[model samples]
Target: MKLRQKAYALAALLYLEFSNRTRRSSLAEKVWEDSSAEQAMTNLRQTLLHTRDVESRHGFRLFEADATEIELNRDLTIDLREIGRIRAATDAADLATLIDLYRGELLAGVDGLGSEFGQWLSLERTRIENQFAIQATEAALRFGGRTGHAALHKLAERLPYSDTVCRATIELLRAEGNEAGARAAYAAFRNRLRHGLGLEPAAETAELIEQEGAAPVGAQPRTPARRSTDIQPDDTIRPSFVPRVVLLPPLQDFKQASIPRHLAPALVEDVTIGLSRLKSVSVIAPHTAWQLDPFSALDEVRSHQIDYAVESRIAPNFTGDGLSLAIRLVRAAGREIVWADKFAFSALSAQERYWDFTNGVARALADSIETAELQRERTQRDANAYSHYLAGRHNLRTFDLPKIRRGRKSLRIAREIEPEQASIESALARSYVVEWVLRAGSDRALLDKAKLHAERAVSIDPNDGTAYRELGRVALFDRDLDLSLAHMSMAADLAPNHADVLADFADTLVHNSDFNSAQEKIDAAIRLNPVPPDEYLWTLGGINFFRGRWEEALRHLSQMRNPEPAFRLMAAAAAMAGQMDLARRYRLQALKLQPDFTTSRWVSRMPQRDPADVDLYIEALRKAGFK
Candidate 1:
């Protein structure tokens, strides 16, 4: 099929899948953007020509009888069209069929299509891939030695790079007392890695193969010991002993690249950090939860012997401002969703706009974990602070001077209402930091205020890592490298697996000229929460800039829309590495964005870890055309 035709089919399929049949005009607007009716019709024709027909009128057809309207075949078997039905099906056969239909790219070699569709396609692909991987692994583990071999083999073939699938295959072989087969499978995997990617098998794989070989033929295969599920009967065990709650890692609807794979772990950590602040609740460490899979809520609850479990999923809010999170609380014994809701919040900025949706979810989960009437009290207080904070956060995303001023105004209101609330204070301090960093503000003054706010927040509740994190930001702005590092380090230690804290810490390290360490930290943060904030990419660009990898720096920095001064700095560095004209353009942009931006001001703003590194940036920016 021609590329143009395929693009049309894919577009039509996407429209039919996402939109109502009656909204053809809306679909055309979305798919074709500003293209005229004639052009859209032509594309639709080309798409129909490329699509294969399964039956008469039910194939991939595009119709536009009315100039203003467009429509697709109602009976098309597009992969996306089948996904929902397949996913909802209780029958394994239907799922397998749907899985088989998902082959290669949704629309290969199609560009000029907007990023929104492309992002959606990417997320859908990831979700399907993860689903296939998980189901395949579960099947292999459950019935590998019985009726699951053929299915397992097919899954392994499709997802050859999945360590989960490989491990499951080995487990299946070992379970059937086929040690030799398992060894052979390991050898094959090792050879495939070496030959295909020029890389050796990971240590875990090597260890597993070696351990398998040493085990006796008749001996039972050893697995890690499961946590004790003993529930003692005593007055201490109240009917609602939901005090101990384990937040299982969230599930990602991997429909966008920004959605981090490590988000599950990070989210779990975030909830853990938030819940730990409550003196009444005993939140489980992410490591202690053991079960990371969102699908295994029931199994985890029973195994971990927890009274309640909180599960969450992160998806982009169609509203275009920030992230939307869905959170649910389930009673361990009954496997019922005791509470479920969706919360939306914009990304964090230097100024306040609104409350964090994820924090709201955490707050709700906290309420659920508490016993009876206390739940109401905790919920009301947390709900009020959370709503105000989210509003402040949304305003902060704008990053303009007026927006920052407005955001600060909102934050002041939040702080007034929840004077002792750590989340509220931390959020408000963050807004001030944003103003200091992005707009015109005294770094020292902002840092001093931020320090006081953050310190007060921590004093209110030392266990709350968010407050410590705000303090770390203040330290960074103050050019106190050691203090910044110490505070961020403490935040990470408190919430070892939280993504936001890790990303922020990585940013601090990059600012301090710890390039290699920053890269590792960023990589780890990405792994913990695959979808990092745009600022994380900006931080990466800074790291690359300091390392003199201009091209790599440009790659990271370009991901951001409407370049900030720091981004312009990286762009200038990239241009300096190659084209002088490009360097001049970026440098001018940087100056325009910050008319008051000078080498002295820039140096003063930075938390100088080393006098020499400070000198280096000062010199580089001057050379790149900064005033």
Candidate 2:
């Protein structure tokens, strides 16, 4: 049987017709982000040609396009036109008709419509749900029972976290003496709410069940305010723009107990608290977890609008090594385990072991979350400043000037939106350092500005290691080796596993004549991030230079992203190895980047401790033709 296929076609149709005029390039890029501009243009042409064919073959006139622009045919009828008109009407009959017109979400059953399209769909889907919810609620109240109750049920499910609808539905069910049915509806709503936000039913909803005095044992009401362990409903009606993370109950099995099971809630709490501290993430409470049925958790996660989930389990090791705690972090869209680790500890007190394990996992989680969420931010079409901040950080990893400037703007926008966010301040500080060192080395004012944000980042949250790392970089650029190492060391202690922190510390170590330790830390940084940033390569090259491995130094520096620094190092390394021709070639490259560079001035600015080594560096650069 032939199945219907309309999503991509409709998406193309709508995009061409939405604004009444669109560039074919813009449309293609929106519809196919993975495709090249040339490919996108070709596909756009083919699709427009195909739409024209459909008109001739099936007698449907969707739209038409020219080389650079597309405009919908004036006579063609659009479904959205009808939806918009019906939406504005005040009559119930029109609302019902509008509701019926939404058979499903726009561009449904579509795949790979690019991030821009996905964003449009997300906003449109949200708009549709909100409008449908209001109308559905009103109709449910007006129609009364059977159909009204059914409409209420539909609205309740659509908005699983809504307390008002659930309470109303329960009351209506109770009024009809359908106590069993009422109980079933409340359970489903509670399950959905718990599954979505890890929140319990509101106090009012809970009282509805107990008022009858026939409440089940599991449905017992809480007499006091919310405890730390309990999940609370969101203050917002819908999920916010930040990446929403949910922590599920930690156990070896749902049907079977793991380590007596009582310790599960505390462990989940640890994860939730750790994730909650990051300004970038929005964490669902552990209280909303632990109690929900494990089988139903996955289905409810989507309705909750969750991005990632943290789950852990403990079991005895097969090798008789006591037990292992296996914690996994997964993204909802792909269910991919972005990070996971298993820790083996002696069967000591659960509380003590939990703290020890969580400390390590929490730090690692912070690092891994940055990487995962950055990926998420890239794919988000309607991401907010937090998302912009993530994207900026990711781009800044390259340490290039154009990208750095772009990243700086993103971070500044993020800071403006969330002035109290320490992470954005840290990132903004680092970007300033990059811009100052690479683009405006003579600009003392930029250094001062960078220092302000670095200090502010620390003042805002003294524990944020990235803040200290940036402070160290600022000091390093200012040639204050002692202060640089001091801040960097503190950063290492605070964020021992963060790749950026370790890399920054390694840079400070190189300047302080601690090559061996620097190599160790930088290598560790590389192991933590297999694709270490370009700055890591620069640090590694510097280490080899001090170790007198000229060939190795040249090899490492040659692969650095920005060839200016790479070429400068290469010139010295080649001359030190007595390769006159290669030295001349590299020196020419370095001079091309900084024509004013001279051996006397460059050597004087060197951070090396030994006068003899400084003399050696000058001699090498002179051999390579630095004036």
Candidate 3:
């Protein structure tokens, strides 16, 4: 029932900690850091054998280790992975299970394997503790009333030194009118802080306590406790401080009794899911939104340190036959409505409109939040990383060569500040792709760098769709059309709600000559992003060009404010349409941007599903006077 050897325990723990396959060399290096490579390999093999023996004796297979790699049995039920359940749980019983599952610190009595193992264990322990505290506090806050109070109290007892846990416990007690209980919780926390760490309760925590008058029982410190200036005022312990937003449940307008009862909640849920898929913003859970008090929403926003609030109201439109959904994006700092929009739709219409509404609201709110963040003051270095990221994204959207370079510089700084950020890595990958494409694939090194960043992004977070899309683009440039299609398809599957992912997928599909499917994908993307970006327009134009709709291609291409990247394609499309004057003009523009651009060389770099498509493109380009 127990692993007698520390090495056996370490072997099993390594497999349990990381769900992915573990290389034998990596396992050896981590467990036997002081040993020679050969000795470490011998040690790892012995450890794995011992662990296997223990598992077999218990009549269970914990892992399978081959000559080169080891992987935990996917079907084996491990209590440690239950940490994931804690974050996903919304009910009291499920929330309480976290308390049971996390009996104590991970690998409680196991010790002193190696420096590598020790460092890894130390980081894992801290991560577990922080994750447990944050998840418990969020669960307690979301499920209010007696159940929530009990959960918070248990959380506070479990992690007494965690300021976030203690604050949540106090806040819940105060909200429930338990003044004495609130004061006692605050007093105990304050005393624990002073005694354990020679620190005091944070200003915000003490302010909550002060509002309830002096502690009734504990003796106050002789010298007033000063707040620590180093930590941010709210939830600084959270790993990622991305802009937090809450989409409040839509309020019903009784004046519109004809509106469907389910429509408003459905819209909110759609928008919530859409926004959650995006890396730009972190959304408050829909359950939390449903339970939030709209009357004192500002107070809730302040309590949660939320950056933006999405409030909606459903009412009868001017025609009375359709329902009007009014959405407003409010900046939490000043409580000002920065953006607002209203969508009118009939109940009989297809649910595609529902997605349209979701996409429009989510995209606009994310952009508005980014704009607000750029103008706001950054209080910490971590905050600066986000500012640089936003600025980088803004510059990249301009589609100008100099601006794109500036964007890469900003992204590099952001990546330097936060090396583990998948979004930053993904953006860097995109910047490289843009540069590679802008230069007409003249520099293969840019594609290599893009691939590296994209690989890193996916490695950091496999669920990041943009990373996959960038990886797919790199594959396309490498002339691996099938691999490009696979990665792009995965990206779309991973982020179905992301307009950018869909647009990118459509663009890749065009190269595969799936014209109808590509058009459908791009159309859906444009639906989601009604005011489409230049990339979306270029994708649409490309699809049209391949479909032999030359005039349509030109129409979309001309709409791009900076159409330099699409100039060659525009010239080809115009020439194919027999517009000789317009084709020459566009060809001149393309040459102005890249004087060395040649049809034969450029066509060689392009990926296509059929060689005939390549021939067609070359013919059109040559006809347009592109040598």
- The per-model lDDT (C-alpha) reads 0.58, 0.62, 0.70
lDDT of 3 by residue, 1-627 (tens): 134556445544665554546777766766676777899899777766777787778898866778888776777676666766786786788888777677766677776675435544643554467667777777887787988888887776777667678778877887888888878887887788667645555444555666667644543322123344221112223333345677887766544366446556654654565465655665665545666766446445544446567776665564556677666676543344556677775443314444555555455555666435423411233545655665676566545679999989988998898888887899899999999877767799999999999999999878778899999999988999899999998887777656667778888888898888888787656534444667878888888898899998898889886788888899999999999999999999889988887777777677898888899999999999988
A best-first ranking of the candidates according to their TM-score comes to 1, 2, 3
Most accurate candidate by TM-score:
1
Backbone clashes (count) for model 3: 0
Compared with the true structure, what per-residue lDDT tens digits does model 1 show for residues 1-627?
355445454554445455625344445544554467668556655544444342234543443234454455465555656754543544456545655665654464555655444544433344445555665457446544444566566665766655456667777888888888887777776566545543444334455766745732212211112323221111122233234567776555445435335433433453465555453445555544543455544444443335457766665565574566666665443233556667652232201211242344345554545424333323235444444554565566556768777767766887787787776677677777877876455545876787788888788767667778888888776667888899999887765555567779998988777877888777655543333456767777777777778777777676666566564567457555766677777777777776776677656556656577666667666667776
Model 2, 1-627: lDDT tens per residue?
011233244444454335666666756665665678899777667666655666788786665666677666667655555555642555545555555555655656665555444544543454444455544555556566676576565555455565557666777777788888778888887777565555566545666876886764555331112335211222232222345566676555322224434344444553454344454455554434544444344434544445556666665564564566666665443333556667763323443444444444344445576645433322212225545565566566555789888878877887777787776788788888888878636677787888899899899778777788888878887888888888998887766546557777887888788888998787656533433456777888788887889988777777755667678778888988889899999888778778887776765556665566677677767777777
Better of 2 and 3 by TM-score: 2
Instruction: Flag the better candidate by lDDT, 1 or 2.
Output: 2
Model 2: how far residue 578 lies from native, Å: 1.9
Candidate 2 has a TM-score of 0.44
TM-score of each model, in listed order: 0.51, 0.44, 0.43
Q: Could you tell me the lDDT of residue 71 within candidate 2? A: 65
Q: Which stretches of candidate 2 lie above 4 Å from their native place?
A: 1-388
Q: Model 3's lDDT to the true fold?
A: 0.70
